[model samples]
Target: MSPHDLGRIYRSEIEEQPAALERLLEHDAEIASIAAALQSRGPRLIRMVGHGSSDNAASYGVYAFGLLPHWTAMRDSITLTVHYDSPLDLSNSVAIGLSQSGRTPDVVEYLVRARRSGAFTIAITNDPASDLASAAEATIPLEAGSEQAVAATKTYTNTLAALVLLAAHLAGEGARIADGVRRAAEQMAESIPAFARDAEALALPFSYTGRMFVIGRGVEFATAREIALKLLETCRVAAEPLTATDLAHGPVAALDPLFPVWAIASPDATLPAVQEAAQRIRETGATVVASGTAAGAVQGVQYTLPVPAPDEPLLSPLLSVVPGQLFAGALARVRGLDPDAPHGLSKVTLAL
Candidate 1:
């Protein structure tokens, strides 16, 4: 609220994530109930839809639902309904919509259509009273409280936590997953300050850069996409996100010394392949910045950002995304831009 606090709101939201996640975990009973109701429907497939950071969270949901419940999950293109008015057969499917404000028109409309098509619809959002909540048969509150910054921080992480919690319950791994989520919150509480400071320092050198790439694999690929969005929202950087394998297939050809790459790799099955990609990128003389538990383990990284190591690799996104948020805030400050007030953006975007 003061001159010195100009850029602190976004960082404060970043710091509030541990508490936000812990708060969401307290609603385990409600999440379990929703999971039970969903399971009762005997869904044949899973469909999720959102925009921007919510979309990234949906991407994570696709992986979470598949890995935990062994369910077939896919991201639904809302444009199919909003733009083309195509008939969709979503019967025997569970459709989910994730919106921080719960007012994203496209997501709400998608859920409305899915419900009409006989799918069991669920909404994950911060506000239980939002239109998105009204569109779904069930709503899981994000419990992230109020996020004033235009770029999502606590709400985004809370969205991820909610999706994982619901998926874990659906998979019958509720207790174990709950424990992992709590432990991840504890780790985040202990490490977020250092993560913020370190990420800020790590991003200072690249403040003037116009573009870069953020890479990861598996669930962490969602982490990469969210981080890239943060950088774009707060710092006005064209931070493109790609999976490590996707990078190698063709995008790697565009890398050079002037470009920087932030490779987010956790301690999981995807680590070795991500490390290989980082090594290859380094060989191209590009500046390679890495994050996550296995960040330091990656060879040829110019800088390693700190992230709390989660109890399981599946919960890694809870910890892995902190540094990228801080990095974006710091980069905005260094460039004399207000991280909370990007040139033309709002807290809630109503897209048709």
Candidate 2:
């Protein structure tokens, strides 16, 4: 409706993210020291545990660090920490638990178990004194302030930033990743207006769509998943995300000529594969909206986002996810659903 209303939502999120990011940056020295300590110990394994957006960050962290040689990054649900009674090699293991509030019972219990098992525990949370943080051997605070909305905005982005920074440090690319993240933040800030406009327009089509598909590859595969979650959680719509390659094997058959397929194709090593997958999806008669670089012929709309300079594809998710966020929020409004409340979900999921 009014520009002021839209601006309030968009700018609130944008403003809070940088503040949270600044807090993380302020503690970089401590994070680096802890990461170095863990590295020197040659942890037998590194595991990430969380739920919701925190779980998504876990996925991204695993992908980010798995690329490094000699490092094993695995995603472990909090259930695994609570239910598994088997002997784990926790003596030299590191558990990175993600929680915005740090008070989720499952997350807190899991971290406590991991700590008891002698694993090097690090809690990434907005709350410095949360139960999860208290249970952790080390805590990295996310500066994302009180997120008023049930659907997380600034916290998710800040978590990703902090996780990527941790991953880079663990992978021995701290300085490089920091530089990339800083650049990505600036790029995200610069591109927000354009992305907001695009998202507002894209929302018009998906407002009534019963279902939507988000597709991507590599790091963007997680990006697609996050977008799907945002749409479903914030927009009260049925949205699914699948790897571009995985879609052809089974999911593609379900698509019709009117199906909306949102493709995320930023410039990564996986771009070629993503582009090829987008092409194949289009052939299946699904309406395709390509949202990345390397534009090709698609049956439907094409929203080409600005390619970040110097080509740090790992950092693209920071900028790419903004449009999806806006799209989800606006689509919710179009559907007469409040983006802030969406269905029956709350900001903090306390139960296991």
TM-score of 2: 0.92
- What ranges in model 2 sit over 4 Å off? 1-11, 68-70, 293-311
Alpha-carbon lDDT of model 2: 0.75
How does each model score on TM-score?
Answer: 0.97, 0.92
Go through the candidates in order and give the clash count of each.
Answer: 0, 0
- What is the C-alpha local distance difference test score of each model? 0.89, 0.75
Cα lDDT tens digits for candidate 2, 33-67:
87788887788778888888888777677777777
Position 292, candidate 1: lDDT: 85
For residues 1-352, could you state the per-residue lDDT of candidate 1 as single tens digits?
A: 4435657888888888989998998899999999999888899899989888999998899889999999989888888876788987889899999899999888898899889989999999999999999999999999998998889989999999999999999999988999999999999889977887797677668978889999999999999999999988888899999999899998999999999999998888898989899988988999999898788889878898857677767999988988888888888888888888888999887657
Runs in model 1 deviating more than 4 A are 1-3
- In Å, residue 345's CA in model 1 sits off its true spot by 0.4
